[model samples]
Target chain A: MTIPNEISGSINNIRPMSQSANRLMNIVADPEYDCQDIIDVVAMDAVLTAKLLRMVNSVAFGLRVPIDTVARAVPYLGERMIVGVSLGLCASHLYNKPLTGYESEEGALWTHCLRAAIAAREIARYANDKTILDVTYTGGVMHDIGKSVISIYLEGSPRKIVQGADSGKFTDYIEGERQILGTDHCEVGAAVAAHWRLPASLTAVVRHHHEPGNSPQEHRALAYAVHLGEFVAMMGGTGTGADTLMYRIDENYKDYISISAKELELVVFNTGQEYEKIVSAMFDGQETAF
Target chain B: MKTILLGVGDLGVTNKPGEELQAQSLGAGVAVIVADSRTGCIGMDHIALPDSTVSLRRAEEKPGYFADTGIAALLEAMKVFGSNISEGGMIVKLVGGANVMDPNSTFNIGRRNVQAVKEVLWKYGLGPVAEDVGGRVNRTVTVESITGKIRISAPGREAWEL
Candidate 1:
């Protein structure tokens, strides 16, 4: 498959985010949005409603009893998480499909994405910023969206890409990709986010996750949080591909995060457990909605 | 085969021959302990830090969590398993302890972990026969007691026995 080198040229080449997801994302980001409003929106889409219930019931969330209704499920899955499920479900086709660009197997990227989202939200909570939880989650979930595009447009041996990308000398994985693929996944992911017209925060996070230090000034913290989330996931052995530890970690992170390593260590372990539950619930190799 | 999972600062041993011991995220800060073929028992731990590396004021209760303590615990367990280094038959192998961080970073935890494990092994007078350690990739190691095969693998790479 030939991948277009230019972002504009690749617009029609990849799958686009669903329209309903786009609409719900706007409503979900608003704090004033009522839970019932979300319930109504989801209630309209029977397919999303069903998938949301299935995801909540999956071992990931660990519900005691099956939640059959979107209203009842809406409470269990908060507004932000419900949006995550919706985005996950709507973009399920893109996230679910296997990408050969990275060392991951089928569904590995999807699992890693969910794990990163969970980690990002947990980090935000740890940092005492409960408001940006949803945005951070979205950022974490979509950080590697560009890799999917690169996988399709890949021109040479996957192993060679892994080797070139695995070198720690580069500033970030994208630099290696740019050297090898002309245009890296971060740029592609950012372009995709722009094309989809999702939030600027999401687009910036995608573009600068590998090098969050260089992200837009306003979205720096979100980028850092997403970067940490991805790092934690890699450390936990989820979604760890050939480029596991190749990227640069902001040494000054300790300045940003005051939490002790011991505490973060436990969170890493806990996140791994949560990742297992959520990954199993996510795209199970079957190309169905949920 | 019973698979014993090792989390950070966690350790496990397989007494019976049918058991398989493994650790999924073996990076620079993590180290795996393999059972010597002589005893048909494998003991593994996820050592987060070596006492030799840094002096911590906080009390570390879990022996499996530290390099020195983890090795001490493993040595004690091996004694109970009827494997003596002096008498022979305590062959060993080490996997992981990779410096997955940027090469220039001051915090090369994988090298530190490997150093700590080495010191402990020296104290016990045992050395690893084979090792696949210190790289940028995460490694998974499986010590199968029944077949006496130790499989080392990473993503996109096929498993090879040590």
Candidate 2:
């Protein structure tokens, strides 16, 4: 779906993805990229280097020997995680917003996105989908990027949309957004992903995370992983606002991801623990209190 | 007056006068509030899942994350504030546990969480004196330590006393 001209204009005005983040994305996208390529890209950017080292040494990682150098930290965090965290740090301002349209306070979306990222990583790890493990984390982080852009347009409409969904007037929140706004977060998020020149896999996850079955076959597993990751975040009470858990779960996720009941529970449990630790670590010196 | 915010998988109790214990933005997670009429102690537990067996070690680290262990820990916390465990001495109230996800999904953790909380409470011969549970709506619950009045609020709705 083509985004409205006004929204598309706003997407264009969004701060471009950082050069280092774009470079990291490029290296990770290549099947034969070596570890040194990632290390060089990170080291070239001092701020990204510091963030990477701090995260690796954060309590969430619990590394007894602190990772002080970008070279070691890059491998420890993996190429996908480095890419995800870099993109997140570069766009932190977008994620850190009130989302007044959704009646969510400042930092709510950021917390939800971070929670989803952690949950997505756990889900992929538990399902033994190593190929998508770290990439799923990046997918989860960017899945809701459209919300930041569309929130202003949604002000005063959240109540009506939620009521419509609950009363069966709409199939779900995405439909509610479509019928009400002529667009939804998924379409808008996909546009933002494209505008940022993100990898196709990440863009696919952003575009179809709400309906993973509709994603391209190649990226469906990662999309499903992120879809369940967001669900776990909501279930753990890290939802952004009124739209939390309002999206339909594509039951076909079972076809793409194999996780038993016990494992799903463990995913939920571990996600919450990791989310808090990471949030605390990320905001240690910041003014926001998680 | 001090207000203590409760996060997911955590609980808080207070005997101090005019204090408030609150759990905000509970999706499928459940929050239980217990207020002692005599001791004037109030406490709340924010539960994330139905069972602790999902991860016993993590549950041991943060028991408030699970219904079974959370209820037990909540009661224990209340006891520290001198709240009585006997019937009629404590007034229990429940909130949250909404199936915020697709209603048709087989894994309705909200329903499971409520059921688990009830079973654990039943073992203690206790039941909720009031409750606002089970819906697609997200809820925020606050308990006043001095008055033992529980307030339930949701998006676009007026706050109501439970």
Candidate 3:
């Protein structure tokens, strides 16, 4: 079992500049940057603008009228949502690559991440925690970023580690990673989050989403949001991979969110519909050489 | 010797005087039995996974699709029986919460079924006086009607009282 050099090098060299860079550049490049200015920047990147427009028209928004341009999408999606979508789309490139360890094919993680993000967003909205919705979306998308890095590190050994973890030969998946790859995905993801200087809230979610009990109360809520989101996504069959078993919903955290068991079910039910809308809108309109 | 079989979505209690009783199961399954001087209530529930909690709402919408609501419904029946046999003080014995599904999956409906039972009992203010839950092994539980003794059976394991 050996790590693939190409994957390892790409992961090691991963700088946080992709989406955050674009957002920051737009913000700093124009101190007085408004939604239109942001739209202008997105429009210059035809591919990105088109993706943004498609997202605005997606069923998640349930827009009364069709949105045709980045400028028209601004008010409908709002500035923050546009930024979040852009960030989410930009990060997809990283997860789009193939990995040997998991059951799903290339880009499966990205699809799961996106569904979790959308689910988190809806959960936050339904719970009336608007302030945390964007953060939750970002956090959910990045929560499993560690898995990607870990997969890269264990390119050849993923199967062995997975087998050990499945057999309970290892105490937990993290231990399996340590045995095979020198370090686990959680640690690498935390490092990646830190490197990106994403909000402390999101970084904490990435670090502790897998183990919400250990996280601080503030971060734990975010972790719970992502945890429930992941659970719903997995149950809905969005990411039915070998690692699906590793995704646990911490029952204790149920006390933190306003969502009751019934409400959570409704959110999960709604999430399946939303997932279809977003995937179709995001993917159906685009064609790229992979 | 008197034994009451509690079927799924149903609750039964032994109320007859001077009866030594036990709650027993043949394979991997869950049964909750409560005894009083006048009556004994026993109920059985089966859930898809041991750890995945299903809401009553989900159960109501899909009626028999989930086990949590069935257990809850059984608990309601037990409460009615408990009232009917109020003359006898209630003593509870419980079993079930096995990983009946793919162990590798995180969603364990069996464990969730047990949790749901606990929650329903807690809500009804008649919590399990004693219980067994969660393991690879299957269980058979029995409770005495008069003395309130519980005997649990499993392979290669001696019968134990709770």
Q: Which has the greatest TM-score? A: 2
- Per-candidate TM-score against the hidden true structure: 0.77, 0.91, 0.56
In the range A1-290, model 1's lDDT, one tens digit per residue, is 23354645766566667766877766655545566777788889888887777777877666788889988876666666677778877776677777766666666677778878888777766554445666888788788887766765563444555555555445555566776767777878888888788887788899888778888766777787888788777755666366666666776545444455445545554565566655566544435435
Encode model 1's per-residue lDDT on B44-134: one tens digit a residue: 7777665622323221456776677777776666677775567776766777776646333434556766877887888778777777887
Q: Compute the lDDT of residue B162 as modeled in candidate 3.
A: 65
Clashes of each: 3, 0, 26
Q: Tell me the tens digit of each residue's lDDT in model 2 across B29-113.
A: 8998888888788888999888988888868998998998999999988877777687468888889988744434544778888
CAPRI grade, predicted model 2: acceptable
lDDT of each: 0.68, 0.82, 0.57
Predicted candidate 3 versus true structure: per-residue lDDT over B1-162, tens digit per residue? 756554322344444545443333222235655555444444334332222243455455433223445545544555665633335365555675543233333334345556666675565466777777655334556666546666775432345666
Residue A78 of model 1: what lDDT? 69
Grade the docking of candidate 3. incorrect
Q: What TM-score does structure 3 among the candidates reach? A: 0.56
Give candidate 1 regions above 4 Å deviation.
A1-10, A28-34, A59-64, A126-131, A165-172, A280-289, B1-31, B43-92, B97-131, B144-149, B156-162
The whole-model C-alpha lDDT of candidate 1 against the native structure comes to 0.68
lDDT (C-alpha) at residue A6 in model 2: 93
